[model samples]
Target chain A: MESLLSYAFMQRALLAGFLISITCAILGVFLVLRRDAMIGHGLAHVTFGGVALGLFLYLTPLLVALGVAVFSALGILKLKERAGLYGDTAIGIISSLGMALGIILVSLAGSFNVDLFGYLFGNILAIDPEEVWMALILALVVLITIVLFYQEFVFLTFDPESARTSGVQVRRLDKLMAILTAVTVVLGMKVVGILLVSALLVMPAAAALQVARSFKEALMISASVAGISAIAGLVIAFYFDWPASGTIVAVSGLFFLVLFQARSYRKPAQEELNERV
Target chain B: MSTNSSLIHVDNVSFNFHGLKVLQDISFSISPGDFLALIGPNGSGKTTLIRIILGILKPSSGRIVLMGEEVHQFTQWQRIGYVPQKATLLDPYFPASVREVVAMGLISLKRFPRLLTRQDESSIDKALDRVGLKGLKSRRIGELSGGQQQRVFIARAIVNGPDVLFLDEPTAGVDADTQARFYDMLAELNRKEGLTIVLITHDFGIITKHANKVACLNQRLFFHGTHEEFCSSQAVQDLLRGEHHLVCHRH
Candidate 1:
């Protein structure tokens, strides 16, 4: 770990990993609760298309990915609202199109070179300070938005009908959430890559919910679990020269299994009590 | 226009979806301190009417007034509470305690951060007390039985102390004993607390016992009158004969 810290690249990767954890864990809790975990997976593919478009156009890749991801995310919302399609169905259509466009653009830009490969599976060693800064700014925006509308999100997630009837501005909040998730997914693609970004968004939250009895507790535990896993994965990857995103996802998966087991182990006691009742 | 006496007024409201008429020329008014039961057959637009009243759906032709303002423009939503039919359809994995679930109703009343003030806490407590779930405030919402979940949702709806309550099939999946207790609680709320209630329910048996007013619908407002007067109405009598199964079927 000390040897890894000497490399600036490793330092940048850790920073990116930490920020991605905070953003993904926060947004993921809501997505998982709302049963929109696939949105992250879908938007990651959309970000891939954006990255390809950026490279093809010789523009700033992150900026272009941000634009495309936001646009496509909003487009998904529109389709869900007006079009006769379920949410996952809309996600399926847009995400597949995104990947297809990305594949075509990558081919058009030249070939599946090292640079493009870095994005697909993540090249943590390639993360620069600039990318770290960009991720922080975008993550800050999402964090502030979540902090501000935290209660509303919980209300909307629990019962959208009650939230709407109580004048919660359900449409605006949903769009805001979509936009936030798009930005986070696009930025997070730098650290965890497109293929595995949603794992970050979903796994820790599921694990936390296994143990937490309340929404706020679940959120805090999820963020902690996610942040810790990213750090732990980075340390192990440095020693083994392993792929950091894959390692982090694996570690989080391990935590989830343990937590789920613990949850089950505790349930028998409660069930026995219920039987007595 | 609004009057001090009436809490809600549905004036010439009509709704259509994809050219299918859901409600046609429906008109009625609900005054303060009245319990109105909206009863109809499966396809008779009861849910649509509730949606229209709650401003969830935009009626195609006419308008509605909620709490003295037009439904489209009314913004004082905290004064009204709505409990949907699928309230108990929450996922088993949903992680929220009873206190937190009831606090959801106070979201509209408070702004960002939503940390409960002393007043808000007491309000949440009172709501739990009202629903007889005070002892289970810290218990997980998903751990409760179906009837208990319904009461939890009712607690959530009334946490903000709304003047009027709207329930769409409040006991949709509940057992008969639970349904009777739930109906009794509702009757107490209406009679003792004088909360104006608009309930969409299937059982006509309880409606005659509790509801002061009843509306029978089948694509149109077949009958709207006092429950006692409704017994004499030919329109409802015709429906009683036409949809006897629906009237006889209770949870």
Candidate 2:
């Protein structure tokens, strides 16, 4: 473990973990609040297509993925608005189609030097300097956006109709949120992989919800939990030669389970007190 | 009407949903300080009509004017406050306190990304005070009783200090005493604050006691006039007698 920090790649991996965890933790709060976890899943798969296209074209995968994910996000928003289809259904369709396209692109690329397995399962130790820069910039952008629109987003999540009547441009905010979630999910894919990104974006927030009494508190706790999970998972994976993404998800899952049990145990006691009063 | 000016004007508006007409040729004008009760049967389109007026839904025909401008063109939504039916439809477990919910009313007035200011905090406190919920400002929304929860929503609606307030069944599911007190507060707001009010309710007894004007709707406007005129109308009398079950009949 001592020698692990000496390697530049391991140091980069640790930094990447911190950045990705904080970003995912913050975005997860909104995703869980909006009940858009499936959209996060869908965006991850769509970003896979973008990554595949980047590999096939010999370009930066993050840029390609960002473009594809944003386009897909906007498409889903427009389709949902026009057709009145359920958001989850739209996400499912888009995600699967994007995945299928990605598979076809990977097959066509044939004999590439890129490690497809790294993107699929995530190899945090293999993160390059360019990818770290991408993660940092994306995290900064998402953080700024959240700070700017926190209140509007909160209102839109709780009661969209009331938000609109109160002069919140609900549709515009909704579309912007979708786009932001897509971008965040795509950026996180490099750290947690397509299959596990949604977990990073959901579980810590769910855990925070069990304990948090207010929105701001929930956000703070969630970010902290995510940061802890990422560092612990990375360290555990390093010492034991385990998959980093799987370990991170498992850490978050444990937190969620513990919080769930704690909440359930306290609920009946609180209700009993209410009854006696 | 003291020449104060009309705030909302509905002209021959009609709406249809899936080949069934919901509102037919309804016309009425609401002045700046009028407290109007919209009473009808369950399918009488009271909610629909309110949504149309708020521009949440578009009428198939006719026009609505708000503050001397077309409703569609009225961009200053801060002037209106609306409470929808079924507050239960919102997620109760959401991690928002009563104060946070009320502060949402001021979101539109601020530039994006800015935190709440001292003035916004004072206004939120005042709105909570008005709704008699000042002590519960820090309480989680899910922790409140039903009546308290409804009052929290009312506080949110009024926090913006709008000119007009619309409530859809604000007292539904609340106890009779709570309902009575809620109306008293509403009446006080209307009379003392000079706020125009439109309430959609199924309770005619309360409507007759409180509303300055009454509109009876049964998929169409059965009557639109003063409370005395509504009570004297033959169609309204038939409605009160349960002759019209297609639309909600307010006594």
lDDT of 2 by residue, A182-209 (tens): 8788767877888888888998999999
TM-score of each: 0.94, 0.93
Candidate 2, residues B151-219, lDDT tens digits: the string is 888888888888999999988788887788888888889989998999998876667777888888887
Clashing pairs in 2: A148-B113, B40-B248, B41-B247, B41-B248
State the weakest 10-residue window (summed lDDT) of model 1 chain B.
Answer: B242-251
After aligning candidate 2 to the native by TM-score, how far in Å is the CA of B125 from where it should be? 1.1
- In candidate 1, which residue ranges exceed 4 Å CA deviation? A268-277, B1-4, B242-251
Docking class of 2: medium
Model 2 misplaced regions, further than 4 Å: A1-3, A111-114, A265-277, B1-4, B242-251
